[model samples]
Target: MSLDFKPGAFSDFFRDETFRESFTYRNSPDAIRRFPFPFDRDEYMYSVNMEPHVPGRKGSVFEKTFDVDEHYVSEMIDRAKVLADDPLRCQSLPHMTLAGWDTLELIMEAKARDYPQWFSLTKEGDRWHWINRPLGIDHTFTFLDESTLPYGPFEYIMRQTQGDWTLQDERDGTLWLDAGVATSQADWSADFDIGMNFHEWHAPVPLAHDLGVFDRALKFLLKLQHGSPVRRFNWTMTVNPLLDTSPENYPKWGPTKTTLTQENLGRKQHLRVELQSLYRLPRSNAIAFDIRCYLGSFEQIVTVPKWGRRLHRIVRDLHPDLATYKGFIRNRPAMAEWLSKYDDGAPTSPGWWPED
Candidate 1:
């Protein structure tokens, strides 16, 4: 199988690098093909041990990354924000504690610390970012053994792009999946607002464009929408087990399989996965779920109880560190230079807004 994609689009992510970090192909270098091509192409398979900072936790993270046909990505983005005011649509998917952020930054930092050249690819401030943006910046992974039953494998489909990599229950061979998880091929802007009623959320940020423009857009959009002068950082990680492909049949993932109507099941490869996205909101934290199947076929939305007030806040020396870390850009001149165009640029008297 081969993946025939727009070679120019990935030129940035495919710069000079160590062969060990990348999986071009096993026997065939052109295993992963792209574009108007007709074949099962290259699939990304990585094992992540999600237990670095956690006291005593371990699990496995196998993921497949793919870009939705440009048109489909736009459609999903529209679907995600169809009614921007809907609480269900605008909530952040993944919410982490300050510790998690530290770990995440540390991981990215390690890549830079080890390979300064690769640092530019992993982090922002590059030519690709000049036009494209970045999404899914925070990635945490661990291993899942036969034990942790209740919180085991999240979801899986035999013939899909994204699946959990696991050892066969018989301990015979390895079972793996190549699935499409997400893409940062667009501008996804969001904000927490207080309207006449309770807190309202506005997610009008354009969520679809060239993946190239995502990182720059995400950093700018996040600060504009969620950053606050009094904004405090906290560290927390929510865990949920959706799929249990283990043979032991442990009481792991309790969520039931979400069955979609045959009509919605576009292809023969259909499997329901209940995965939750965690996010820290101003008022309450959230874990929004989607009984999604076929990677991007369809999704049934679900959520959990909100993280109430009273969670401990970890204070940090944030003023100057904003640029080196989060909060704000250290290079005001660079930032302003980036935001020169008002039509889709920096904050004007009215602020950067969405198209009505």
Candidate 2:
């Protein structure tokens, strides 16, 4: 069933939630069960592990083209605040205007078709009527007309959606990071990488270049066709469910890394997962990339027995370089120690499913 958040019936947890200052963000018991656990094995490593973005288990993150859940409204609110503080977070080059509209159409249609109760999109020729009940947005605008919308098409639709979006214009046999909105990222800067090509933007990732991971991935993406989308999972460690982990604001969140202790590690240290999807837009031929972030706390994750066992093993045996790259090396020892209490050395079943 689709979700509904009508007035007076909205849950108090969401209405009073915060992802910053006091940091009251959390997952409901149901949300934790559905958490997109990234590791399918006891160990973790980077690879071009992508698959068709087809619908999966009925209530999973992959069940829809775009997954909207309990955290949708709160995330959009957080995104608005981030953009207000730093407008550069959303950028689209001159040539990316068509790509912006392409992305807007993609998201609006997906959400309207998937969750009709909450979103509705009606098109009459070039004019379109869009209603987004969750965000209290309803407007009729002419498609491809920039003057009809408050912001550029990319920024306009992105503000109402969850996750960070990047539009890549393909040219010269490679994808260019020409446009993007990155409010909820993992130590990356959209502004800094705006004009960078595929390899140039990914140059900082350790060991992946030597492994030829990026080379193969770039080759595959260059051939992506319209109507077909692919997705993969990427994860990192974060402190306190903070979504705005961009390096530009590191000074604000950097010190929190040193604050983790045995008493609070379970609640503060979180496993941040990104469900990255790449879609080949029909009109612009630009690839629309969605980096949807999911944060599950140690306390919530350990509730699943298999998850607890596998998490401890992965953490304790992780490569030192990976730990440092993920910004959790300083707290890895404590995390493993805390998670050990939940793991009894049992051999976890072979997949990431909670039922396993």
Candidate 3:
């Protein structure tokens, strides 16, 4: 599915929208069908549910190495606004420059290969020419030369790409969160998390630590070979389609949580899912953790019968601790009650697929 992203050329392929004030963000019908609903069954729990980041059925988020959807352009705009307000949202320690280049290479190559019409890259030894039509970027530079780009390699490419990312440097038998871009994160602080080790950064997560999910995940990631990446899902609830849900700016968005009611809950409440993928860079051996976010309003999600039913069960039965940790404990009862109207006590099929 080639998209028309040429500058100033309007097309339904790229939506013009906002994720901030007057929040006009929405999912098209196609996006709703392909929403990455996290639960496989009627209940939810924290686990190391990692899977191979391989291409899947067409028209699905899993169909590409880095899924680019209708939200691509607008999401990039939102990220730029976030960075403009808080430059610290994107930071790379001095030692992680090589890893940044590695990440830049990975995204550019994947996007050019998977989405040729919108992106193109050509390389001659170390010199590279890259083009991103959607963002109106066209440049030629030495591959590993940081001076050639406007920002660090990681930040430069990340600004053009969707999702929040953390480049983890492995040493002392653990991964270090030395660098990251977390503007659209789910209530986490990249500024505070920087330089923390694997466990240290994940210490805030609730039941996962006691379940040893991180221990096993960290061990598995340490052995992750180049050319083989793993992906997982992490999710929470948000009041609106606002993407910049960072802790630093919580005062701006936190108050909005109190505004939900059964009347507006279907339109305002959103399930924020993170399609997190981990990769082992060939040269630097650093792991690039891509935390891609996908937001679907309750109304958009309930359009699918299976999703509607499963979501009701998951919300109603979700453990209290997980709800509190996810920052939606106050609204869980309202959400569950609202979702129960769509769940007719029918049996849902086995997987996350809506068409099945």
Best candidate according to TM-score? 3
Alpha-carbon TM-score of each model against the true structure: 0.20, 0.96, 0.97
Better model by TM-score: candidate 2 vs candidate 3: 3
Poorly placed runs, candidate 2 (over 4 Å): 1-16
Model 2 lDDT per residue over 161-270, tens place: 89999999999999999999999999999999999999999998888899999999999999888888999999999998899999999999999999999999999999
**Residue pairs with backbone atoms closer than 3 Å in model 2 (clashes):** none
Model 1 per-residue lDDT tens digits across residues 219-325? 33233211111111111111111121221222321111232223332221111222221112232211111112111111111000010000001011212332232
Indicate the residue-level lDDT of 244 in model 1.
19
- Clash number by candidate, in order: 49, 0, 0
Off by over 4 Å in 1: 1-83, 88-269, 273-356
Winner by lDDT: 3
Candidates by lDDT, descending order: 3, 2, 1
Worst 10 residues of 3 by lDDT: 1-10
Give residue 238's lDDT in candidate 1 (0 to 100): 10
Alpha carbon deviation, residue 284, candidate 2 (Å): 0.8
What RMSD does model 2 have? 3.1
lDDT of 2: 0.91
